[model samples]
Each structure stands twice: as structure tokens, then as C-alpha cells.
Target: MRDRSTGHPRNAWYALAASAEVGSTPLGTRALGTPVVLYRAGDGSVVALGDRDAHRPYPLSLGHVDGDTIVSGYSGFAYDRTGACVRVPSQAQVPYGARVPSYPVVEEGDLVWVWLGEPSLAALRPPVSTPWLTDAGWDTFGGAWETAAGIGLLHDNFADITHVAVVDPVISPPALTGVAPALEVELTETTVHFHRDWPAAPLPEWQAKISGASTTASYPQREEGAFLAPGLWADRWDVFIPADEGGTQTFRFTHAVTPVDDHRTRHLWRVSRNFAPGAEASDVLRPIFESYYLKVREILETMQQVIDRDGYGEDVNVAADLAALQVRKILRRLVADEG
Candidate 1:
């Protein structure tokens, strides 16, 4: 586990918001405990800057956007895309040292990523690729949540799946309860992967309805995923239910976690499926996915409350925690290296 006092690592790219969510309006958000404002320039490119006005320390997101600049609502101080104070309404000359800090931003794969560290190091590492979110052959649906838990807990939740049977019985197979599947783990310098192949089991009602398979039918399932980086995790499911053409159905799940502060986190999730590839399919699955994540959020938030009231104790690990422990180890190393 990470030392709570060390705080979040600054030398990494975190997802600020979904591409579709950021537009002409200035968005106010917090990352790594610093307030940030995000908006699009004239060419539809993202710009991230310190959210506070340099003159009066007011929130810049409350201001309105000019053609390519953001004008402060409190004092009419206008700042350009570079975060330079280009215009002052009350005076002719723009005061020296009247500019806000600007951060590097990248828009890729339907997400806007921002670098919150030294400007020089932003070029050394880029955010992980998630091409499937925009691929033509797949349909995707997702939503964001303001979680009360820490980022580490969210990563741990994704790394271990045994909790699914207890927390989300509607989607998990009954056989998973009290039964551990053989897990294969692969580790890299910055990533950890886990794979598990479960024997033939009856399909849960929710999954059977989506896959067009009978609830009584049994199928082999393959679960695999990787911790791509501190900010992203990607996983997939391959259910060997016979398709009309004798193939299997695939579901891809991706999570982007960003820390808002020591006790709060931002979680963004995306679910993509190759079987359904249209707007109608996305509409049908959006609410179902939302419900699924809402339950997860409730449970995680409750855990956070308990941990806060009574301090965290020594952790005991079992066979099911192998991948989750690896996630914590890798994160601790990254945080230390940054320090």
C-alpha cells in the first residue's frame, strides 16, 4: 500500500474528463489536489490551466470563454490559451506576473489527459492507448463518478474478482462463491497482467439476456486484464457461448482513476462490446452499466467510511489477492521513484 503522507505522484498523466464532456464551456475540476480548468480552443483542442485567477484568486471556470481566451468573471481579466494575461479591462497595460500556470494536455481515444508535473518531463511519457473506444467495429457506453474512496482501493477492486460474487451476485456466476480459480500472473516493469480460465458454468441471467444464450446453457469463460498504468486499467471477458457463426462474444472494460485529494477520487469507466455496434445497442446497455457501477460505488464508499472511523489495520492476504498485491507493489514503487 502507498504511504498516505507521500500524496499522489505528480509525474504522470491523469484523465481529466471525457472528450464529449469538454466543449466551449469551462469545466472546473481538481486533480492531484490542485484546482484545474479545462476548455477547448478555437480549433477544438483541449487547454488545461490553473483554475484560480492570478489577480483575485477567484475560480476561472466561473468565467466565460472568448474566441480563444477565457475571461474572468470577477475582474474581467482575460487569459489566452497559453495562460498569459493578454487583456485587462480596467487598465491598458497587462501587469507583469499576472498569468496563471498552464499544463500540457492530450486528447486521444475519446479522453482528455493532462500532465500535472514538470513541463519538461511531459514529453518523456504519454498516456496509455485505448483505441478500442473509438474503433468502428465496437459499441461503447460509460459514465463517471465522484468516489469517496482512494485511488488504490479502486485499483484493488479491479485486480481481484472474487469479490464480484459477494458484491454483485446478479452478474457473477454462482459457482464463483467460495471457489478459487487457478490464476496466471505476468509482470513487467510498469504493468501486471492476470488471466483465469473458468470451467463450463451456467450463464447468469443478465449475461444470458445480452448474449442471446439460454440461462440453462453452460459455457467456458476466459477473464484477462492488465494494469496499464497508474491511471488506467483494461480488462476483457470471452464467453465461449456458441454464436450463430460458431464464435464467442467479447466484452471489454476499461477504468481510468484519478485522485482528487487524499480522501477522494475520480473514476471513469467504459464498456465496449464487439457483438453490438450501433447507437441503439449503446442506448440499451447504458442504464444497465450505470446500475452495475452504482452498486460498486456504494460498497466502496461504505468501506471508506469504516476505514476512516477506525484506522486501517494490518492486511492479511490470500491466494485471491495475488494480482491486487502486485498492483499495490507497483504503485508504491512509482510513487517512491517520483519522490
Candidate 2:
């Protein structure tokens, strides 16, 4: 087992922010316990650099973006997209060590990911593919939350869906409780996949409304999800309705977890659906999804607080924790290897 108090793996691609959030101004954020500043360059490419100025140790995010350069507000020093200090108003020649660390960044779908690991490894393994977020056929909507918890807790929470029955009973189907659905788990070098299929499961009110079925209707529900890496988790939900009642509908839920530090995490969630691809549907569904996520965040943060105060006493696991345990093992290995 890895030391939970140590920290997260540094050799991973963490989703730093939504693409829309970083436009022309410098967006200050943290990843893997490092303060990072993100901004768009002249060509509209996302750039991630050390948030502080090398000269006076002031936050570069507080500065202004000038074309392809960022002019520091504290010392009037200008840094380029590559983090090279190009202009210093107080001196004629730039100092030899005036450059801040520039992280490799990639914009995929609706999110911008920053690699805080070895720069060479970034090109070899990029961020996971999330086509549903960018696909025209899917209607997508979500936002980010700064949770007061460890990233590992969020990972565990997402890996085990059985908690949905207790944590989000209102939005989740009732069938998730009082019965054991057939489950299958697969593990790869960098991912863990879980599948659950339940027959004749009651549909939630919101889903029934979209499918034009009775609120008491029952259908076959299938859930497939994967822990792609340290920073990404994706799951898909399919409810098989009758042909007269809108046939079948699919929903994809993505959770992007980035550790602000050992005790804080930034969780970004997005939901994309194949049915009702329009702004009206998004407006109707966004609030429900947001509320459920906020509830989960509250629970996880409370758990963190309790554990911090009382300590993790004799933690135990059951059969349902297989996937989460596998994730922890993989994360342990990854963090150990990096050491």
C-alpha cells in the first residue's frame, strides 16, 4: 500500500481548467501541490507556467497578457509563452536564470490538461480521449468544484457506484439498492473498468420524462465506467426503453480530478447525453446533475474532515471495493515508481 499522506503521482496529466475558463487573462490554479498560471498565447494555444515571477517571486497570474507574453505586475518583467524572461525593465540584459517552469499543456474536447511530470513523457501518453464531450451528437453541460478533500477519496467514491443508492437516492434508481446487480471488473496497466447490468430497474423521474415513459416504468439499465488514470474517470449509462417510448437513451458522465494539494482537490464533472440535443434539455438537466454532485462533494469533504480529526481506524473493505482497491494498488505502484 502507498502512503496516503505522501501525495499524488507527479507523472500524470491533470485537467487544470475548462477551456472556456482560460481565454485572454491569466487564470491562477494549482496542480500536484504547485501553483500554476494558465493563459492563452497569441495563437490561441493554452500555456501553463509557474505562477510566480523568477525575479521577485510575485504571482505572474496577477500580471497582464500582452500578445504572446505576460508582463509581470510586480516587477514589470515580461515572460514569453515558453517561460523565457524576454524583457526586464530594470536591466538591459536578461539574467541567465530568469525563466519559470513551463508545463506541457494539451487542449482536448472542452478541457485543458497540464502535464506536471517529465516533459518528455508527456508526448508519449497524452490525456485520455473524451469524444462525447466534443461530438456534435451529444448534448453536454457541467462545471467544476473545489472540494476540501483528497483526490483519492473522490476516486474511491467514483469507482464504487453502490454508494449512489445511499448518497444520491433521489436521482439514482431505486433498484441500485436491495439487490446485487451482475458486476464485471477489468484491470489494465493504467486503467480499471467496471460494468454493471440490471434488468427491470425502475427509472428515475427525470429520465422517465425524457423517454416519455411513466414515472413508475421499469427498464433494463446498464452502466459501464473506467478509471482512466489518476486524473480522469468516465462512465456511461444506458436505459433500454420500448420503441414506442423513445427506444434507448445513453448518458456519459465524466469526472476529472486534479489535486490542488494532498488535502484539497479540484473536481470537474460533465454530462453528455445522446437524447434531446438542445439548449432546453441542457437547461433542464444541468441543475439536477449539479445538485447531485454537490451532495457527493459534501459527503466526501465531511469524510475527509472526520478522518483528519479522528484518524482512519481499522478501515475495512468488502466485495464491492474490488475496483477501488485495484485503483489504489495501481496508484501505489505508479507513485512508487516515480520515487
Candidate 3:
């Protein structure tokens, strides 16, 4: 955890989870620099929010689970799921009858999202839902990576598919030996067109021996990298985003540096798919395919290890990588301008 101002602690909380396990609707507890408790209520809702500021009462979740009563958290007193006080676990009297804060909790696409709009505002806002592999008929897999430097380097790598030869050779074989990749940009609000193609008649085995992909038919160039290939991927649609909040809705962070505050910029994400499993065009795998997307993460982490050691720039360049570089610049401009 290197420190950066703009809500690092807050962003870190999500990032840690992004890299952690949520179980198969299971119950488990892990410290997120806090006494965070996660439980699948009898009502089938996954709750994740600020646990009661301990020093008060027990986590509302640990309280008995009744029909509508959710033991969310504790103040100097105890409250149920609905933020209603049902017991006095600490002092004889519930302090001032005040209630612990509650986050909007909901489960979708196999993951639980906790609204973060403060203890009060979260309740007023509707929760966002996103597609996941846990849903029926879809398969998803991905891995993580930290480029030679900050977010900009990653933007280049994910946006440009021309570097398959060097990054994860196991996936991209016959290494994309090119002088430069073609560049085309679109400045519309709808979509930023940054496209690249792989060699004709690419071989997975040959590429497999080299990188994470045999060929880069197309890759999602957003906060996170989503590659679309015939095999070893969740879907044909390459959806990519940099960051996400409340598990259900992720920012398909395309571009770089979005501001959460003046000192810090938040990573963004764009979810290309729908949270509704019924909306998937392919056969549903739910858990199976959902499990597959996790693999993409594995491959990416491996590549990051290599990139970190070697670094982000090359004296020799690929035209495709040039476009990738430009995309990073665009992203940086958005972040700066938005600020």
C-alpha cells in the first residue's frame, strides 16, 4: 500500500476486495483495516458496509436474524437490519436511542454491493447492478497487473493489443513483431474508438507458449484490460474498466485519473455487460464461466510481475503501442480537465 491522497484508504478498501474472495454466498470475516463482517442474511442479501465503530456494540450482522430485522451495526447500542433498535447489548439503556449507520446492501451477478454514499445518503440512492460470471449462462475470467509505473502505463498496455508478444507471450505467440500499430481515435461521448487487430490465422498454442493470448482480436482498453478472443475468455465482447464501487456497478474506467478530490483521482470503470443474467447472449454457465473470468486476473498478475521488473517504455516501439500511448494521454487529459 503506497500512499496517495485522494481517498486512498477508501479506494484501497475496494481494491483489496477486488482482489479478494467473496465466497459462494458464504459467511466469513476478514479485516479490511477494520472489523468488517460479511454475512448472507436469511433473506439472501449480502451485506457489506461500515461495521459499527466497535467500541460501541457488536456488528449488527451478528445479532439474531429475523424476517426484516437486519443487525447492521452498533452505536453505543444495538440495532437490527433496518437500523431499528431491538436490544441493549452494551449499556442498560440504548444511548440517546440513536441508530448505527446503514449501507444499501444488495446481491447481484454473484457479488454483493454496499452503497458508500455516507451512512445517510446511501439509503436514498438506488443500488447499481452489473453482470458477473456467477449468473447463469455467462463465463468470465481475469487477472491483475501493475505496470512499470502508475495507471498511465497500464492504460497503454490494456488499450493497445500490439504488445502481446512481450507482455504475456503465453497468450500471444508469433510475437507481434511490428514496427508500429495503426492508430484511429474518436472523440465522442458515446465511445472512444481505439481498435487493433491480430495476425491472420493466429495459433493459440504458438501464442500460448509466448503470452496470455494467441492473438489480440480486440482488447478492452479501460481501467482494467478486457481482451476478446475466441478462447480463454469470458465472452466475445471485450468489456474493460479501471475501477468499480459497490461490487455490482463497476466503472469501466477508460482514460486515466478521475477525480474523487483535488488531491486524489479515482480510477474509473465501465461495465459493458448487463447485470441481468437473462440478458446474456451465450449459454449460461453462471458459476463455471464466472469462475473462468477469474483466470484472466491470474494471467494479468503474472504479466505485471514481469513488467514491474522490466519497466513500461521501450526504445523500440510498435505503431499499435503508439495508439495505446495516445489513449493514456487522453485519459490523463480527462482526469485533469475534469478536476
The model with the greatest TM-score is: 2
RMSD of 2: 1.6
How does candidate 1 fare on TM-score?
0.94
Poorly placed runs, candidate 3 (over 4 Å)? 1-36, 54-77, 82-85, 90-92, 118-138, 141-157, 173-175, 185-193, 206-339
Q: List the candidate 2 regions with Cα displacement exceeding 4 Å.
A: 1-6
lDDT per residue, candidate 3, 1-339, as tens digits?
332211211211122123134422323232212434454445545555345533454554444334434443334343455554555555676556565444455453433444433455444533333444344433333333222233333333455554455544544324255433345554442124554433233333532222233244332322123221100011122223123411221223221222222222222221233322233321332333334323433455455555556544444655555545554444445334435
lDDT string, candidate 1, 1-339, tens digits: 323333577888899899998989999999989999999989889999999999897999999998889989999999998999999999999999789999999898998999998889988898899999999877888989899988877888899878887776776765475467878999997899999988888766765666567778677888898999888899998878675633687889999989998778999899998874578767877887787688888888887887787767567789878988888888778888987
Best-performing candidate as measured by lDDT? 2
Q: Per-residue alpha-carbon lDDT of model 2 for 1-339, expressed as tens digits?
A: 323554688889999999999988999999888999999999999999999999887899999999999989999999998899999998899998789999999999999999999999999998998988999989899999899999989988988888888877778876687576656899899899999887777788887776566788778888888999899999988888887887788899999999999789999999998887789878988888898899999999998998788776656888778888899889988998999
lDDT of each: 0.85, 0.89, 0.36
- What TM-score would each prediction reach against the true structure? 0.94, 0.96, 0.48
| Candidate 2, position 191, lDDT | 93
**Candidate 2 Cα lDDT to native:** 0.89
